[model samples]
Target: MTERVTLITGASAGIGTELARVFASNGHRVALAARRADRLATLADEITAGGGAAPIVIACDLEQPDAGDKIAAALAAEGVEVEFVVNNAGFGLFGHAIKLDRDEQLGMLAVNIRALTDLSLRFSDHLIRHRGGILNVGSIASFLPGPGMAVYYASKAYVLSFSEALRGELAPHGVRVTALCPGPVPSEFQARAGFLPGVDSLVLNVSPADVALAGYRGLMANKRAVLPGVGIKIVPFLLRFFPRGFVLSVVGRYQLRKR
Candidate 1:
């Protein structure tokens, strides 16, 4: 029999690392994928030492067009089939759309949008056969229009919509899909985005470990979307009361302040 495994991308650090640990502790054999081979190796060792099955570490940049195919091939080579997929590999840049480097923004889309969609749909047969699940990491930005970080916010919006639609399509097949939307997570993400957290971030921030646990629980419960904190859970609800223009203005000012 082929071994069933959970495939988690962006497993090198932050919420992705925590998600891997949580899944492994719950008895899921994991496949860790990230650009950082050393980080992945360390995480693999930690999981094994903690009595979890050793993880298969695939170190490849998701920016490549064939990243999904590579991940599939790696798993096939090991005789493992995916029972769960965590599309947690993504990044953002904090700047006005016109001001940011064009190539960098497009690269973000390659990983955040294209690669995520590829992996989510690539193993549909395996997911159906195993009655599996998918957990996609979106952001609070998914619900709002961002003026400064336009492309990044839009990419997460795609994640939310795509995950929901995919969930409906797969529900009858006993496959659960959940979008994990967090707000202001303190991680390498802020650094890479060139963002310095301000008052808003402090108000909304949740620890990466807590976010991962919440995402795990939410996915198991078959929730359509998991917002990890009380602050985050209120965001969409509050968005309902505000006009789109007003919300856009607010986000625009916030991003401008960060810049």
Candidate 2:
């Protein structure tokens, strides 16, 4: 019998790569998509060397307008129906919104928000038709308004909100939509966001392996949301009860103090 196929965005590194590992270990034939094809190739090689299934690598910049169409076409041609999707490709821009280039901020939004939304909808449709599942990678930052990283936080908030709503809509169709809200994991993210130099102590962060395993299990079980770490699991509940003003004040102080 042919193995199940799962398409994972951002599969070149970090959470994405770990997610691929989890899925492949569970007997899924994975399709890896990321800008770095070499990285994906290396990861696939490692998986196969370890006696796990090798993933098909599809390299594409998801920020590009044609990325979604391209990926969908490529998968179809390869005869790999997407049995599951993990939308994990995203980035952040730190510093004041005015100080950052407008183009960069918008580009981050394009990737983090637009790409995620497009992938979710496309995969949701496929899953609804095929009885698949989806896991959208959100962030703990989504639960609070980030002052220094305003656009990034808002984009994640959209992710958390959308995942919840999508879960409700797709549940009856035997399609599960899981929102993965992780607090922090050491990865390429901090360096890219220009926040690497300032960080002293890490927060209640979980390993990418832990995050991926928890998220994968939740997605497979059709859980509505998966906040991997204990800290993150408790945060959204607090954010819901706290008034917007209080939450903002707390978030603002936390961020500004880092600078």
Candidate 3:
């Protein structure tokens, strides 16, 4: 059988790194893109040494305006079409919106919203042309409006809406689009976001490897929305019955309150 190619963003560590491993083990050629070239190189080397095909590593900040186009161009140069797409690059800011730096918010939007949308739109076209698949990693935060993390939650909400709507639009072409909405996955997320200083570990968390496995299964099943972790799965459903204002309030308090 011909090798299938997958393109994953934020592929250096956390969920991205684990996702790359799972996809490679399942026999898909991967294109791993991240800002941390050193980490990506190490991972690529390990994949090769472990007898899996080495993925193309593109060092992209994604906050840079041209990152998405660069990723597309690199893939074109390789002459290997991407059959699977994973848009998993994102970050969160821990402070109140008013207290956060303006540029910091912009940077957050750049990676969390702009880059993900660019890749989804760009790669969905590529997938449509090839009749393949797309997997977008959104957060369970999408179900509510977060106060301290307002922008981040809204960005993921956009991801959830955009992916589900696109799935309906792309189904006719044999293209499958799934959005994996995981909650509080134990990852570089809190540390990188600088939330480790204030947040309690008691809040729900899951392993990145577990998220990757759920993502792989969700994409294969063509699930519209994949919310792994039973506790996390209950969240989105609970949000539906409650008032939006109420959910937002809870998110704000939970996110901002230091235990």
Best-matching candidate per lDDT: 1
Q: What C-alpha lDDT values do all the predictions have?
A: 0.95, 0.85, 0.85
**Greater-TM-score candidate between 1 and 3:** 1
Task: Give a tens-digit lDDT track for model 2, residues 1-259.
Answer: 3345799999998999999999988888899999998999999998888787767888999989899998988887777677898899999888889899999999998889898888888766668778998889998887788888999999999999998998888889988889898887888888788775333225567899999999999988878888887766788787778899988887777777766
Q: What TM-score, over all chains together, does every model reach?
A: 0.99, 0.93, 0.94
Tell me the lDDT of model 1 at 196: 89
lDDT of 1 by residue, 140-222 (tens): 99999999889999999999999999999999999999999999998999999987899977898899999999999999999
Candidate 1, position 84, lDDT: 99
**Backbone clashes in model 3, listed as residue pairs:** none
Ranking by TM-score: 1, 3, 2
Q: List candidate 1 segments past 4 Å from native.
A: none
> Better model by lDDT, 1 or 3?
1
Error of 1 at 141 (Å): 0.4
Model 3, 200-256: lDDT tens per residue?
334446689988999999899899988877778777677778987887777778776
* Candidate 1 global TM-score: 0.99
TM-score for model 2? 0.93
lDDT of 2: 0.85
